[model samples]
Target: MASEPGFLPRDGLDRLIEVLRRDGREVIGPRVRDGAIVYAPIATAADLPTGVRDAQSPGAYALNAASSAERQFAWANGPQALKPLVFSPRERLWTSWHAPANGLHFGAAAHTTRPTAVIGVRACDLAALDLQDRHFLREPYADPAYRARRESLFLVAVHCTHPADTCFCVSTGDGPEAAKGFDLALHEIDAGFVVTSGSNAGAEVLASLPLAVPAEAQRDEARAGVAAAAAAQTRRLPARDLRPALLARIEDPHWQVVAERCLSCGNCTAVCPTCFCNAEIEEPVSDGSVSEHFRQWDSCFTAGHSRLHGIVVRADTLARYRQWLIHKLATWHDQYGRSGCVGCGRCIAWCPVGIDLTAEVAVLCDDGEGVAP
Candidate 1:
């Protein structure tokens, strides 16, 4: 291998697994579960779902059983992202009491998920992580829990060999190929892995693994393979200056059509890696010694998402739906300097109403009267 950061045989994966397990780290990777590939406790690399394809539809997903066991990772995204595990669904923010010692005690939380190894993370998911870093870690009010998990865990990113129809990572300026921020980025080369370091952390992981530096020609092949995987993606969105377009169409008739089937379920935001909105619920103790306020997932589709003085802004479904789409595609760029969506397509597959983003965006970009209520 020439420009190969390092080439490791399949046995090297086994060695890496042993290293983590020996150190009491829980190894989580993709495994076949009820016909789909899910992140679960993997004892060995052999347990991973190899030579299988995953079929996904809106509100429905079926993992395709391998025909001859020649799996090239034929799925797009999974039901869950690495987000929930990092930023929990609910968390205790603070404790309070109205007694002589009237004071607020902030909750002490950490990832504490055991020294773990996450394998087979895709490129788009990695991109989502970058966005999360900005939102959760880079903010003035940095989330200590998120920072803890991010620091403790080791990531092994897998370069895509096949992309799904629902994936539009190219349009979002991300990838169907692993780019950066990984302890190890693996491109399947023949029966081995062409590995590269995304950072100093990645290089350290490599130093601990058994690998061979590839020849220069091998590097070009590895690069070409990544490019081909990206080209294989069939989904696309014309996001050229999409933010301004969304702002201009706040009152577009298309939103009404979208709202009809939109269910206000908040599925889109939940699956989106960058959509970070939460609500707090407090529990009052009878003793008055302590009250716990919990931060949990919240969505704009719900009425409570935009309530002030007991009055709700964008009370109707149409306005709520418009707010979500506009903010995700447009205003997010204004605020974060990056688009909120990584084009992972989890929202498309998980929406119970089958409200496809690409389909709705097309309607929004149009100048016609949408389906009237």
Candidate 2:
């Protein structure tokens, strides 16, 4: 073991897991679940899915077990991204109590978090993490919950060498490989994994592992494997920057065509890693002495999301669909200086109607003129 770019043998993954656990960090990684690979608590390297990959398309996803015993991490991405773990789906924001002395007293809610180390994080998800950081951490008033959870977490990014049919990270300039933001990153090869540390914490952990400086040949092979994966991606947004095009076509008829098939189910937003929309819920206690406020994930497709003064702003399905697309591809740049989408393809994979955002973008851009009624 040394504080340098090295090769961690396949068997050394167990040691890495054990080291994290010994340091009082709960290890989380991808695993076989009901039907798909999910990020779950894992105690051992054996918990990782072996010879498993996923076949994905618009509105369709299926896990196909591979015959190759060598490819331990064959799957590209999962439905759940790293968003939920940090920016929780549901959380108490505050609580209020009423008393005779004071009409109402507002106080912060209690939140508990644990030190975590996430393995097998993909590049697109890493990009999503950056977007979330801008929204939650860079604000004038930062989200305390997200900051606490993020500060205590360790990230182990995995370079994607087996992208799915729906993958487009390469087009987004986010993946096939990770350039930064990971404590440690790994590229799986035939012999083992080529590992590198991007931070002091990552270097400390790697220093304790049994690793060797990867040979020049091994490093070349790892680079080649990642390139091949990038080359394999077939689906992508028609243009790298769709903000201007999408904004110009806000009145495009393509919205109506897709809205006809869309359920307004909000499936895409739920699965999207970068969608930060949420709604607050207030509940009164049985005695009406206290009220608890909670924040839950919300979608733009929902009618209530656009309601104002008892009127739904974007009442129709077409309007709602257009709002989502515009926000994700057009206005997101104005807000965050980057596209909200990381090209993860989770929206397409999890959408029930198989509504492909890339396809929708192509249609909207095909004919700039608004269609006549």
Candidate 3:
């Protein structure tokens, strides 16, 4: 059974970690590392990025230490999201060997998965996870490896109280507050966390924690914080459904302008949680007796991505950039019934040359042609 909203004091966080670990789940959370906040194995509440806030803008990201020690999830988000956890960046698919007596032999690759409990998950990440699940675990062709990892996971979401300038999850209707797809959700307040369970497993875990009914004041503060976070965002897509307008601008002059600045380095796709392009590669042994097939993350920005019959379809940066933009904003709606962007703003913050997709959409849809109201 799901439990009512409750309050867990600051010290209770450590106990939560202990309980998850005792349940045989490896707890992963945000931590300050390499001058930026990144997710890693966390043992206690002390391992969280306490009093640390991130400053993010187009093409830039930096972490600053705040004066207060009470807030742990004070920042909006980091470059990494839940994509890599379920859809691995690289994994072996299968291996083949040749024997003189047996001719050829093939063996499926073993996928090892461990039960994981991740803390500090954001609403945007949960939304992205849903999209990935649709792509990988949908229909009759579900990916076996992704399914194994996905099933062995537990999600703990944190409501966003501090949004970066690039954030626009409110416009996408995916964030500021977690609405679904979490086992447990938390709103970090000054004194402690206002926690709620969304699943029976989360309720069982909450029962183990020392919790108290959240005061009216704490609940009001949490609501106000999320509202303030929503109001603080300065960037937004021109419309929630950008399919018609974007598809119509396939030959627009703006493609040239964007391509001039785009390095075709694939950084945006790499950091984007919803972008799931990958390439299969074959690795051969020294004796040529064994060959291993591996699947690794790929991006449309690469020169070889659109190659066909020794011909590069998207030969230049303009076509490549246009393909990426159109696919992410337009064609994805045809395939997934929604835009690929989750409004996490990682593509905007992690781009080396500061390309803002929201700004691009505004310019492309400036005439208000075919834009949804």
Best by TM-score: 3
Mind giving the per-residue lDDT tens digits that candidate 3 earns over 115-158? 99999999999999999999999979999999999998888999
Q: After superposition, how far is residue 70 of candidate 2 from its true place, in Å?
A: 3.0
Model 1: per-residue Cα lDDT at residue 257: 85
What would the per-residue lDDT of candidate 2 be over residues 224-302, giving only the tens digit for each residue? 9899998888777654567888888877777889989999999999989999889999999899999999999999999
Model 1 spans with C-alpha error above 4 angstroms: 1-4, 22-24, 67-72, 98-113, 213-224, 367-373
Q: What lDDT score belongs to each candidate, Candidate 1 first?
A: 0.75, 0.87, 0.90
Per-residue lDDT of candidate 1, residues 1-373 (tens digit): 1123788776678787776564677888887776566788888778877777766655666677644364445456676677876777888766665656655555544445577788888888888888788888876888887888777778888887656656778777788787677777887755577888776656766777898877667677667867876776655667575787678787888788888888888888888877788998989888767788789999998999899899998798899988887888778777778777887888887788877777677677763222112
The C-alpha stretches of model 2 lying farther than 4 A from their native spots are: 1-3, 367-373
Q: How accurate is candidate 1 locally (lDDT)?
A: 0.75
Please give the range of 10 consecutive residues that has the lowest summed lDDT in model 3.
364-373
Q: Compare the candidates by lDDT and give the number of the best one.
A: 3
Q: Single out the weakest 10-residue window by summed lDDT for candidate 2.
A: 364-373
TM-scores for every predicted model = 0.88, 0.95, 0.97
